[model samples]
Target: MSHAKLFHPKTPEQLKRAVARCARLHSGTEAGEGIELLQTSYENNAISWFLERAKELPLGDYFLWFRKASGITFEDKNEWVPELPVLAGVNMAVVGQLKEIASLSKGHLAVVSNDGRVAVVMDSYSGFLQAEPSPEEIVYELAFWNSLG
Candidate 1:
């Protein structure tokens, strides 16, 4: 069932839909406790770690330099493990969705998931990533989505 070679860049709208499909698939798992953990995590406590060591270099080599130094792989090439997919699908989809909506120089408003997790990482090209709790919040959503499956 591996299709790792088939990976492609998914659009925000497509990723949003794929994430929804994954969420629905997750819902079918019938694991209420599992579902609830992500629910609570997304709803209340998402943490976004600001990497002082991972800042963009003067030459716009932030990601390259950071990858070589810290190795956290924040915004490098987002590849899907088509063979052993994480969260069955949601994480890959979310990475794609978040990249589209959050990583750009002029990022869009927001992207939401079926589990009710919301993300808004805007205006990041000019500087490093900073987390601010909106009238709502984020990494709780990230951790929740990451924790699924």
Candidate 2:
């Protein structure tokens, strides 16, 4: 299975860059052969398009999600789960870590998370992605997915 995670870019430009880097990162890897990005406009709101996509997924179910740093917040029931606060509110620390990954990758980071709390950073030049989640995050994500059932 493809590793899934939340993505939050700070701006549309970052989103675009991230997506492009994702496309490149996946284009070469056998595991990512089918990876694709749905083109969306970010003219008015930076994450409006992404939020709409997130809304389409079933609540409490694990799905690939992302938001930008300093992005808008969603009300309860508008995010991955009804009880969980908006991803923006709870995931800034994760986003902060991702920002460091992006910088280290030289802006070639694609925000694919295997769990909502962890990110798999793809290095475009090397065509490798890595996210070593803490044991606690792993167990939490397992519980989270189990709760979805």
Candidate 3:
């Protein structure tokens, strides 16, 4: 897989150049195979590096789930579970305390927590889909399916 470096811009020209570079890099790759790129303001270099390169270098999708409060049930025995929204051609379902869903200026999807404590941002290209479920719910579901084997 190819990788691109994100530059820190000090002027409009630098910013333009960075955008141009990003466009060129994107253009050069085959469809569905472009390099995953990330950018952030330089504050803590370690955090910056981790935030920028974590998703791409690992070459995998990251799953985020919130744990439910006590006495919550994962299964709907009497009611049918509805389908989640399809984003970038993939299906996504929200569980737990997600308050809002919005696309960022750059077209990335952001899911905000109900308490406003955290937001989960997903890349439009990387197939990072979101689902809302308590960790226990996910585990139980997985276990139920795994028992078929």
Candidate 4:
């Protein structure tokens, strides 16, 4: 098996644990072969800091602005055939988790599933902004969990 590192949380439990760890003290634990969880301080939250300066725009608006500002349109929303209600359930669960962590700004974390791949345009009011498909590529991870059922 390939030891690919995971940067985003794939489940509610995983997201919860990551939030807790990211918020609390970190001892440089080994998440995988090349993943290292580090303690994030207020100073490290430069994106959040910068976002705060703009009075916290909506996630969609921010996404658009990011695209315009950077002049780079990322991947388009993919089309996927969901497996009945499982995909929807997993999407809701994961989105809820992200919102709970205060990492979501508005209900704009559009989760699109297609061809066994999940895409996300998630954002945070805390200045945690990403270009597209989510910075850590975690939004696309819903496919893995959805496939388990």
lDDT (Cα, tens digit) per residue for candidate 1, span 1-149: 12112222322343343333334533464332332222222222221211111121111100100000011235685432212111212333223333322332122122223233322211111222244434332222221121223
- Between prediction 2 and prediction 4, the one with superior TM-score is 2
Which residues of candidate 4, in runs, are more than 4 Å off?
1-11, 20-25, 29-31, 36-149
TM-score for all predictions?
Answer: 0.20, 0.23, 0.19, 0.20
Ranking by TM-score: 2, 1, 4, 3
Model 3 worst lDDT run, 10 consecutive residues:
139-148
Highest-TM-score candidate:
2
Model 3 per-residue lDDT tens digits across residues 1-149: 01212211221232222223343444454222323433322213213332333222222221222121112245652321112221211112322112222211122222222221222332222122134323222111100000111
For 37-147, candidate 2 gives per-residue lDDT tens digits of 332122212133223323332333222223222223477422222111112222332333433333333222233222333222222122212353332221101001111
Model 1 vs. true fold: TM: 0.20
* Evaluation by TM-score, superior candidate among 2 and 3: 2
The lDDT for every candidate, in the order shown, is 0.24, 0.28, 0.24, 0.25
Candidate 2, residue 40: CA error in Å? Answer: 5.9
Model 1 regions more than 4 Å off: 1-14, 29-37, 41-44, 48-149
True-vs-predicted CA distance for residue 100, candidate 4, Å:
16
Worst 10 residues of 4 by lDDT: 61-70
Candidate 4, overall lDDT? 0.25
Write candidate 4's Cα lDDT for 1-149 as tens digits: 01212222122233223223322323244222322222122322423333232222222111111110011234863232111111122323223233332242231222323222222222222333244323432211000112212
> For candidate 4, what is the TM-score?
0.20
